[model samples]
Structures are given as structure tokens and as C-alpha cells.
Target: MKKHIIGTLLLGGWSLMMLTLLQSCDKQEVFSYESEHALFFERWKQVSLSERYRLDTVNYSFSHYVGVEDIEHQFKINLIGNLLEEDAEYKVIVVDSLTTATEDQYTIKNPVFRKGRSSDSLTVVVHKTPVLKDKSVHLTLRLVENENFGLGYMGYTDVRIRFNDMPTQPTWWTKEVELAFLGPYSYEKLETIVAANEGFTTFEGLSLTEKRKIALNTKEYISEHGITEKNGDPMEIPVY
Candidate 1:
């Protein structure tokens, strides 16, 4: 009777082990998942950046965050410079000491988005040059698709940025300061003001809403009396 009972218990144990193995195999096959590939910058980053950084700014960095969440994955983020089309007034720099960065200058520190982390970053460094002071220059960078990952978002894939050591008036600077009692001034004029009295060199730090408030007042003033000088004389605004 004892031998028969022991045999029954052994058989039950074998069946339980087999079931566990089968379930493990099924779980391995059925519970698989694939995470999509996406590499992007945060939405707040300007799509096209144009600003005057302080002359003291040695290096300017542009970054894009990897959208992939895989821990064991390695990626290559290559920067390809898409130049400005041939125009007499414009300059083309395929590779230069002034534009293309050296190993010491620009580096991809950690392109790998390790396991368990959702994001990684790639940074491009722009070295300041005397040429940037004389004229504003821009370079366009496109994120090419690789075997590991494709370009993530349409809006963020291409980055076009112009940086200058000197304050080149921005395209947004439409109206005169005297008429608006507000913004929109050339770098040279700012320098003049600094030399003569007190002034802010750039409005880059100002919030967009704050900038808009000044613009609104300018518009209201113009609508009421057309743009007038401090002396109450009619002033001309350049369209170009």
C-alpha cells in the first residue's frame, strides 16, 4: 500500500513539472513585444533657431533625444550638413575649421540609450569664429535613417540654425523702438546704446508672450495714429 501511494505521488509531480515547462515555453513565445524606434528633440526646441549668443559663448550645442527605450541597443547619430544653395551673397562650407568640428570640438559622448531608460541624447558643438562676428551664418543638419532607427518626427528631423557673435537684428524685429517704445533693434544700434548709456544686447532671453505684448502695443499705437516719432512726426517703416 505504501509503495503504491509513493508511485502515485511521483507521477503527479512529473505531470506538474511538464505543465510548468510547457507554460514557460508558451509565455516566452506569446509574451513578446516590440518597441518602436523614434529619435527626437523635446517639442519646445525651436525648429529653426536664429539667435545672437554672447561673444563669450565658446561653443553652441544642439541636441536631439533618442526616442527608443531599448537598453541593449547601440546607435550612430551622424550629422550631415546641408548647405545653403549657391547664391553670390551666401557662403558654402562643406567642411572647415570654422564650421566642421574636430574630435576635441564635437563629440557624441553617449549615443546608446541603455536598457530601462526611455531617452538618450546627441549633441553638436559649434565653435565660435571671427567670421561669425562679421556676418551671420547658418548650417542645416538632417538626421539620416540608420539600421538601428529611423528619423523619428517630421518636424524635428531637420534643424537649421544661425548663430552670430554680433547682434544681427532678427527677422522678427519689424518695427522701430521709438515708435513702439519696445524692441526690434540692430546689434550695432544696441552696441551704440551700451556705449552711450544702458541697453540690453539681445531679446533672446525674453519670453515670447512678453515680446508679443510690446508688439500689440505697437500695433494699437500705429492703428490709432500711424507710427509717429517721439517728436510727433510721421516715421517711415521699411518693408524689406
Candidate 2:
């Protein structure tokens, strides 16, 4: 009887151990393991088209987070379009500059894609730059395609730029200027219009409504002076 009891206890212990091992295996398969340094794609913000022409700038800004200690990030820009023929020519101007108002202070390290590729697509490799922690960098990209594809489709097709992490800053601007040329005529134009006006020197202590009215009147004054022109052209504008 003593031998039978010992044998039964050993069998039950073995059964419990097997069950625990099976549960562990099942949990491992259900969970996905990802590295701490993986990067992701963020949404792109479209800037104003009028600003593009006025400031001669056109681009979009995007950002993603990296959680690794030290790892190289890799990314690519992919363009997709059926309208681009094999012989069509295109240009991509990638300007790497600091986001400041100092005139032409940024450097253009990579001016790529002057001619279209033999295929209907092109890809540009983006490597990591030296950047500080918790701060974001900006990359200005201009896609100029020389072809006639109607009003809306004149430029590059299916445009998207990708970014990867680097240890250093690529290039950026310290300060930027906002030009509100149409502030006086628009309903939402604010007090800043007075500052932007060429004829005004000081609007020290004006109310919000007073400032808006002044801006509207300034718009009329400029129109009477023939300082503005209107065209139905549609273009891409850059917004900060």
C-alpha cells in the first residue's frame, strides 16, 4: 500500500509539470516580439500653395519616434504613377537646410533626380543624421516634373518621403518668416497683417477688432495702389 501511494504522487507531479510547460509555450506563440529601435511612418502635413510661390518653397514635414540606444535607421522615398512614361523627364530637389530666416544659410548636400529613371518610378535612400534628443528636424523636398498632365497632375505623382534616424543634425533653419500677403482681404486675417504691411510702422495698442478692420482697410488701400494681382493658377505652397 505504501509503494502504491508513492507511485500515485509521482505521476500527479509529472502531469502538472507537463501542463505548465504547455501553457508557457502557448503564451510565447501568442505574443509578438519587437525590437526597441524600430521606426515608423508618420503622416505628412500639406503647406499652403501660395506660400510656395511667394517664398519659392514647397515641401512637407513628417516625424517618427525611435526608442533604441544606438542603431542605424534606413528609409526610402517611393513614387508611384501610371501617367509617367519611360522617356519622361523629372527633377527632385532635396534641400537640407536649417529652418531659419538667415538668407541662403542652409546647404544642399543632395540634389538628386535631375533626370527621370528608365523605369516609371524612383527611390531615394535616407540615412540617419546627427540630431539632438527629443527635438525634431525638417527636410524640404521639391518635386518638379517637366510634362503636361493636366491642371491637377502637373507635378510628381503619388508623392511620399520617408525618414530614418541619425546621430547628427542634417541641416535646419533657426528662424522663419511668415508672409501674409492676402491678410487684408481674408475674413480670418488678424493683427499680424498690420505688421506685415509695408506702410505701417506701429500699431501699439489696438483692439483685436480694430486691428482686423485696419487690415481690411489696408487690403483695400493696397488694391487701389495696384500692389496685388489675381490669377487662377493652382500651385503647392509650403506651411511651417
Candidate 3:
């Protein structure tokens, strides 16, 4: 009777093992030759499989980089299907209707997936034109189907990049900066302060006394010369 029970247990275990193997085989992916030649854009830093991993648009502000003529901005293009042993050139073109930047304002590098690699960097050279100081421009890049590659994910086939040199209010302009130092924030005021104060970019790590002195000097300067904001409002600084 014991031998009979042992035999039955062994038979059941063997059957379960075979079922698990079959299930794994079913779940395995089978890629056709045509399906292995697709590409898409995704953020290289994201490790998640969620939809957020797909990259659609990116924004850059040349305001952060003062005196920089141009910069090379790069984003990742990933392979959806298979890695190749030989280099594969991909086609990307700017959508003229969606692009506001002039031809000389930017340059797109030739996109190519290097040999034995599944991804490559698509670089664009963005120039800091005078127009960007007051306004922003968009550069939209779309992937075109070529002999070597096809578009991968539907929504991630293209990316829009908007760049500007316009300076916005810094985060360090807290309530303290408003009530105790500068009364109100203005782009013109900030520009004036940055111009007058050498090597002063942000108010992030200044002492209270130093801030008070700078505020007093700026207030005097504005009062003496009558510097107004772009909206014609009087630039005022609180005195305490």
C-alpha cells in the first residue's frame, strides 16, 4: 500500500513539471525578421515598463547657460525588436510645420544604430538666437520609415523640443525676498540685478545681511535711474 501511494505521488509531480514547461514555452516570444527592424524613442533613464517610459517632448532653457552660443542636446532612440551585427542608419526629419526654429538655429545629427548595439543617441545642436531671449521655438523630429528600419511604438515615434533663453523668476525669490528685500518680482528687475552684481547668478546661498545690503543698493539704483518693469510698473524694494 505504501509503494502504491509513493508511485502515485511521483506520477502527479511529473505531470505538474511537464505543464509548467509547456506554459513557459507558450509565453516565449517569437519575432519575425520583419518585426525585428523597428525603432522608437524612449527615455534611457527610465527602467519602468509603463507608458511613462516613452519620451514625447523635452524642454531646454539657455537662460541657465549664460554666454553659451550653442549646445548639443541628446536623446535616446531604442530598438524595439533585435540588435544587429552591422550598423543601421535611421531617418529622422524635422516637421517643418511644427518647427519654429530657422535652419541655422539647429542641426540634427545623422541617426545610426551602431553595430552590436540596441540603442543610439540622436543629437541636435541648438543655438541661442536673439529671438529666443524673448520667445521660445519648437523643433519637432519625426522618424521616417527606411529600408533598414520601421517605426516602433505609435505615440513615441516622434519628439518635440522647445528651447528658449528667456529668464523666469528664480525659485530662491521666496516670500522673504519679496517682503524684506525686493518688493515684487520682474524679469527686467532680475536682469538689472544680475548685470549690476558681478558673479551673482542666484540668491540661493547668500547671508541675510548680504541680501539686505544688495537690496538697499539695488533700491537706490532703481530709484535714482527710474528703472521700470516691462509692464510699466514702478520697480519698488521694501525698506526695513
Candidate 4:
């Protein structure tokens, strides 16, 4: 990743000055400004595009990560600049195309954004039921036209997400590992390991370092037992 421009700007990026400035400015400069966030009708929030997600098998909970930037605070750099308070709501519409109906309404864990804070976000949690195991789910959440935030980045006002818990090989899982030990990508192998080993839980539960440890540990497993897969076809983790 590139380092942002040193100092001065809160973040290294260009801002458009289409609207008139709220305060006095130099000949060609806008001294202060604020963006209003708005979500158009049926606009899907740009979350993740068909990304793989993991479930906490121990608790049956799912978490979708999203971020909110302090665009207003970043503009308040001048001596007379001011930042306005903003709010974000967890407005979601379930796609009726799924085989099962999603009724979990505990969307936003903390929906309020108090003043003075640079930025904040809703936890945006999803609770899974036993019925979801066999159904495909699609969720679109938009930060609609709320009085709190009126302006936002285009194509980012809302996020459309499809949820899945299958433990497929992630990007970090290398082809080298696949050739040497694990077959291809096996959800069944992942399930077997987690069910047998108390230490091996959800893939998300492990830290980056811990996940790395599992990679080498898996190599050891393959060396001792020969290459293996719980399910036929496609590579996967070796289960005990």
C-alpha cells in the first residue's frame, strides 16, 4: 500500500469543490465544506462483492465488516473550518430470492454516532439459524436519506452482501501448500478439523500469526500421514 501524503491533509486524496464554500476562501480555494450522505432508492451499499464469510460455529454468529470515514472532519483543517455531526443507520432489505426467509432484525448493534468523534460505524451483525445451513442468503444494506448524513461517495452509499460459511481456501492459502499437502479446497475437511480440535475453531477466530502457524502445522500433518483429503476431488485440509 502507498503511504498517504505526509502531514497537512487528513488523508491523501483529492476532493472536488463543485459546491460553493461555506466560509470565506482564497481567490481559487474553498476554505471549508461538508458532504451530505444520501442513499438513492434501492441503492446497494458497496460492501463486498460476493465475498466468502465465516460463521462462529460455537455461537452461530456472523460478522460483516464495514467502514465509515470522517470525510467532514478531514475538511475541517483550516482555522475557521468546522465539522458537522453525522449518523449512519443499518437499513437492510432481504432479497426474496433465497430459499429460506431471513428474519434476524438485530442489524445495527450501536446505531448512534455522537458528536466530537471523527467517525463511527454500526457493527452490522448477522445471526444464523439452523435453517440457514441449506439456504442461500442475499442482503443489501443502504445508509438511506437520513437527516444526519446527506452526502456520500457514489457507489458506496450501501452494500450488497451474499453470506456463506463454507471454509474454502482463502487467498492466503497458497498453491504450494495445495500441491504439497491439502488437495484443493474442501469445506468438509475444515469442518472435521474444527469439530475434533477444540483449538481449531472458526477461521476468523485465528489471528494472522495463528493462521500462519496452522499452515506449517498442516505441512507437518501431511508429512506424517501422507497427502490426504476428507472429501473426494478438490484439495482441502486433512482431518483426524
- Most TM-score-accurate candidate: 3
- Look at candidate 4 and tell me the lDDT of residue 92: 31
Number of backbone collisions per candidate, in order? 2, 23, 0, 13
Give the per-residue lDDT digits (tens) of candidate 4, residues 1-240: 133444335332222232234222322232122434332222222348875332211112122111111101010111111343533352434334531325562243444544444444434455444444455455554444345444343333344445443233455335644554344555544534443344554445556566556655664554565545554443344332
Model 1 steric clash pairs? 71-114, 71-115
Residue 9's lDDT in candidate 1: 100
lDDT of 3: 0.77
lDDT score at residue 216, model 3, on the 0-100 scale: 78
lDDT of 3 by residue, 121-186 (tens): 799889888898889999999888888987775556678888888886666788878898887777
lDDT of 1 by residue, 48-163 (tens): 56743321112221111112111121122222222213211111122342343333322223344333334434444444554544554544444444444444444444443444
Can you give the lDDT of residue 30 in candidate 3? 29
> Would you give me the overall lDDT of model 4?
0.39
lDDT scores in order: 0.39, 0.34, 0.77, 0.39
Model 2, 141-182: lDDT tens digits are 444433421112122212333333322311221122113222
Positional deviation of 223 in candidate 3, in angstroms? 22
Best by lDDT: 3
TM-score of 1: 0.33
Runs in model 4 with CA error above 4 Å? 1-81, 84-101, 165-171, 180-183, 195-212, 215-240
